[model samples]
Target: MTVLEADRLSADSNRRRDPISSRGAARADTVLAVEGLTVGTGRADLVIDVSLDVRAGETLCLVGESGCGKSLTCLAAMGLTSEPLIRKSGRISFLGQDLSLLRENQLAEIRGRDMAMIFQDATAALNPVRRVGMQIAEVLVVHRGLTWSQAMKQAVELLASVGIPDPAGRANAYPHQLSGGMNQRVMIAMALACRPKLLIADEATTALDVTTQVQILKLMKELQAETGAAMIFVTHDLGVVAEIADRVAVMYSGRVVETATVDDLFERPLHPYTRGLMACRLHATTTSHGRIAAIEGTVPSPSKRPEGCSFRPRCPYASDECMALPALRPIAGIYGADQHRAACHFAEDFARAGS
Candidate 1:
């Protein structure tokens, strides 16, 4: 059965060689749309003016260092934010349902069934006392209306599909008894149990080793291909972006500074922050510099953002125009450029000078 699924995914890949958005500028089907999302405590806005669309069967990677509000954005989309930190103003629409208006009970019904989140730390995500398989089966039982025995059978299959050696035996094991990789795989199995329409992986691979990260990422891609679910992958790794993203959003100080197709981003990044991020990559430094480049300074606290560009303090290309926030608008043309947008006053000037 797994082999058949693999065959189907291969055929699917052959039919659509690029990410869904690569075939066109406008996404005909949007699974999740976030508009002007702002979240904050009464003191200050932590996530401001954020917007993005996740088309069906696409992977959008949110790349930024910690504290850029990527994870918060995900939580907001899920309507999971707790006290004090309230959603200031925004709209989170998933599969035609306005999530912002949903009550906790409604959101609870939506979560795991329609949208699922894979947290960064799988250990904490999984129940400590419950058998991993039982935990996974619970989702199936609740959302898919399956009996315990039936759900258990499916859970074992899920574990096996995720590469567990002895799916049945592993299924009986507690999360603490498994390796970090195993635990992570279990979290993924739980998230995929319902075959959700939208999957949000928040730094899901951050805790894994290099080999495990690669394996987990490959597994996710295959699972996504099979499920055809829209995904929002949050991470600080550009390498992960290069490997899995169809579209990339570079966030800084709680806002997306740039957005572009994965190919365009790697070929020519428009935002200074994006460029700085790429330069920080080890692969980009084959033999040029003795040291890998580093983006100077740190992501500022939400309350401490500068008057203009939040990244202006660390950006090398800053000018006086950067003293004012630049709206995230589409980068003006050279054809096929309507989809690429950057929130930098000097985006055009920099693009032209670099060209």
Candidate 2:
């Protein structure tokens, strides 16, 4: 069967299984809601009008190339955006509380306790001078009111829970002493130390080897399931998205280009950008030419983005109509019932043609 046919079948099956898939129900289940988020420096916006929501116990993967603003969005959600770059406009609500209105101290209180993030580089995020156990213990000490001795004891158990070997001994090792995978496991232990309601993993497995990456992904999924926490997993790898994402938001040039369930995205990608990304993945047929398909032209820098669709210059299907920016709108007909959205003038046509 063709991709569109598969998407139709999947949608039909989902509808049959859950007849009351309403926006109201979705909103009620949301653990984090971000709307009209715009992060920028004085001269240019790095992340523009991005809105995202993750339901309780859901994994939302934000996928894009290096400069596509995926990481910035995650940082903004965590209120960790620092100087030079600022959140110009947005409302970030966590568990129905508006985080934008909270002070840094207030946000700090919620951070490790209610929401936590695992940065892209675990070694950099963890302190070199501090023992791994002390780092994890710090969270429990600050947020859970545990004594240093008690916290350190539990820290070893946390490390063991994340599959670290000889956790008691390993906890005493400094960040630099551990290998990449072990440090990442330590970071996971720290993030989950507080049993956060929301977990944002920004390329948590990007630096690990294939075997270690798989283990980390499996560990994360198991932990998330156990705690019933919502997750925002950021990555450029579609393979990772397929493994972990319930839904995906595809971003390009600082704006969200498409959003859909994982199956719908892989089966019937509507936006040209999303399709380009999918095509870029290596497959058996890709060996024919000894050259992989690639989206032409690098993502335009935020400062140099075109007046219309930021992707217009690179989009093969660009036209005069595309000179006007397209809002991220739902596709018409059956796809609309699934809430599949794409920001492209020809999304409907692309969907119809199954391109």
Candidate 3:
């Protein structure tokens, strides 16, 4: 079967399963399913042909470098892409409903009610002039048709739920009055206010200190468990994915290079890009240099994307076959045996050769 056909079958099978259980043993359904999503800007496709799914209560992470198009994918999903800037193609289904060709009115109706996104930079995302609580209440007022007073009350509760102390008083304070961590909590609170079926956190903890990052991630997980909201976490941090993700989709250039469970990715990464990311992340046990290590070269610009595997330019294992675009193919051995796939011609040989 073709890639698109295979993805459709996977979605169909998962839809029939309803793995996430509810009260009294009822089942909560799959929350989001995206297939063949291509997002671009200015006639140049930045990210191409991405496919993945998240059942309610599951976390699927998109991990890669800055230019790998993680943030653009989230933006496209919610219809937040600026006009004439982001052009998107392909199927984006939420609750088995397609969101790809939705009009503004339709998208607005679902943006906060069924889906919400936590932006990358928390401080900048929250309005400086408005009180944080008021901003959270806006979604309730706009979508749920709640009175301002009622929404504000629930907004304070939401803030408190995200571990914001003295939420009632803090709610009235402007964004600038809060610290970085607190602002991030407010963003989370706003995103979770409606108990959205799917939450997209685009590098939500990037700006915070390590301790605060941990706290925020823990809070997010707790919220997800409580509400059973599926999450699409976009980040460059493999360390963060190790802590939170059930499955990971590694992107390079505009496409997914590798996808596997968190353990599978760390232990037996199949794609060259995945392997490079792992190698770059490994710290030296016996080192002569104390400097932080990094992957060499840069991700090519979207306009200048290579013909073959996007990672071929940077891949240490590149060969003549790397000149041809490699489709995502199933690997012979892995944890998610049927699910394990790598877009490389030499994945098996690379594994045997211990790359």
Best by TM-score: 2
lDDT of candidate 2 over 1-355, digit per residue (tens): 1332343344332221222143324467689988889999999999999989887788889999999999999999999999999999988889999998899999999999989999888988899999999999999999999999999999999999999999999999999999999999999999999999999999999999887887898788888878889999999998888877778999999999999888788989999999999999877543647776899999998888898999999999999998899999888754544568899999988888874
Off by over 4 Å in 2: 1-26, 336-338
lDDT at 91 for candidate 2? 86
Candidate with better lDDT, 2 vs 3: 2
> Which sequence of candidate numbers ranks them by TM-score, best first?
2, 1, 3
- Evaluated at residue 74, the lDDT of candidate 3 is 80
Candidate ranking (lDDT, best to worst)? 2, 1, 3
Candidate 3 pairs with clashing backbones: 48-254
Q: What is model 3's C-alpha RMSD? A: 7.6
How much is 245 displaced in model 1, in angstroms? 0.3
lDDT of each: 0.85, 0.88, 0.80
Better of 1 and 3 by lDDT: 1
Which wins on TM-score, candidate 1 or candidate 2?
2
Clashes of 3: 1
What's the number of clashes in each of the models? 0, 0, 1
TM-score of candidate 2 on Cα atoms, chains taken together: 0.93
For model 1, name the residue pairs that clash. none
Cα deviation of 302 in candidate 2 (Å)? 0.9
Query: What tens-digit string does per-residue lDDT give for candidate 1 at 47-159?
Result: 99899888778888999989999999999988889889999898888887788777888888889988999999999888899999999999999989999999999999999
lDDT of 3: 0.80
Candidate 3: list runs displaced more than 4 Å.
Answer: 1-28, 282-292, 353-355
